[model samples]
Target: MKDTFTETVLEVRGLTTTISGKRGEFTAVENVDLTLKRGETLGLVGESGSGKSLTGLSLLRLVPKPAARIAAGSVVLDGIDLMSLTEDQMRQVRGRKISMILQDPQTSLNPSFTVGSQIAEALALHTDTPRKSLRDKAIEMLRRVRVAAPEHRVDAYPHQMSGGMRQRAVGAVAISCAPDVIIADEPTTSLDVTVQAQYIRLLQELQRESGMGIIFITHDFGIVAKVCHRLAVMYAGQIVETGPVAQIFDQPLHPYTRALLSSVPKLHGQIGRLPSIEGTPPPLWDRPRGCKFSPRCPLADHRCRNEEPPTVDSPAPDGSEHWARCWKPEAI
Candidate 1:
């Protein structure tokens, strides 16, 4: 309930991450820029391979090394330049100042350790809690995240819990440090519809309690609508559009954004063949000459095909700016 319009928690500029493969080097996350304010949620939505996950990892400097590297960018967290930090310094920042909730709790959680031990480990790494008090702090975290019977569940290993419970355990670890920001990359992917809804609400409640910023990466527009205050639509490693959630949903300026929204099933519309975006996304190495989405865009022209469009500001009726990377935003 506190004001969400507080100080900026994270700011990323021109974040470019590249991967070197047998095929050659290609940018997995290119020229990305984003900002997150305290208590606000920013949705990073796009189709598979749009580099949403890569972007999150790059923010933390966790991109796999040798094969993948952050080629360029500045990641400033709470006024500290993460890029300038030494490896040892960055380690202190990773779980203490920022944390990530990856999809698939089965993979994220350590099956060998009790859920409470995992949470306690994070607390030990980030805080100076007494050794004997770690268990109690861990139990408190489990209760805070809504794990059932925190005292009993604390001793349960990941495999002993349900999928939803495991995911909550992962959340408990992420929030145990009370980090300034959290990057949730499709964290609800393994849960059922009802469990997914519960998980989303749990995140909202946690955000309200801590006023921490969140970068939620997912492909589901419904999740974005429910949890995010703003959105950034990515395509082929580039951000195609970004603005307030309601403005972009009601009046999407980018063709790709419109295409993505149209693909979502409507509950009220007359039932018929569901709309689908024709053609597949271009591969990273062989991206098109101009606009990346030009090949499948109905509004594509010669200019669109030959020249990459710059991100331009398209002001909404309320005077807030909606940015889009398109040459023909007026066509919408």
Candidate 2:
């Protein structure tokens, strides 16, 4: 028997998504690879336009249609290939086998409907719970997320709830079906620090109880450190580095990863101005010839600028293989 702690819940390989418009088609997600284990939280961190959000959407086959589509790669969830499923089958998979907690509760929750009705809608779509009992189940879910006076709040509309409460309601919707995996796409972006910490703790408690794997997408390294066990750094739609969180935090191999870590403000030392990475990520259509980050990387040389770096495997202190895409990871 495989160890439960190490059991793979989701595996993605060479996952590429394309976006189409009047500007034509461009790769928005390129050859991205990820693995999530049972009960583990994997942080997907990068700047805006780094494809962190799109990667999560693509994993669930929820990429906006007509405008963007998944052109390549495979997403295997619990040994089932999601790419092979038909639209109807995929609908069944969503909210049942897997779920997503989008970043904004305001957008996620319907202002027209009571929070209970929205949660009941999810339960109805995915489960066999009788119609009469869905409200009870919804209330139970609200309680699970630690909502105050869940019974009263359950009947309130989205606009009536606090930002944190609304986010918790969104979480209740996501976990209503007991999915094997949950993709939380910057779920704490709108909340205050206290509320964000509470939300993280709530997610941790839920994961502990359900043993569900989570792909936590965020731009905040502090939140990543608090919640994620592994880390994947994205750049220009591609994953540049991935490994155990502590190992990567201590010894980041990719230049972009190092630069990102360097920019984070420190608490222990004398307060000083934060270091900033120069230049923004390139547009998808205008990505550089070799390494996408080479243009901005201080360590880039002729080799890095002229040739694409292959993903290299380095031994991590935690006995896991740390993967980095760079010509000279040692130079950093």
For residues 1-332, write the lDDT of model 2, one tens digit per residue. Answer: 11236799999999999999887999999999999999999999999999999999999899999899999999999999999999999999999989999999778898999999999998999889999999999999999999999999989999999999999999999999999999999999989999999999999999999999999999999999888988999999999999888889888999899999989887885587888999889998778988999999998989888899998888774577588999989634
Clashing pairs in 1: none
TM-score of each: 0.97, 0.97
lDDT of 1 by residue, 220-313 (tens): 9999999998899999999999988988999898999998998899899769987899999999888998899999999899999999898789
Model 2: worst 10 consecutive residues (lDDT sum): 1-10
Q: Every model's Cα RMSD, please?
A: 1.5, 2.0
Error of 1 at 236 (Å): 0.3
lDDT of 2: 0.92
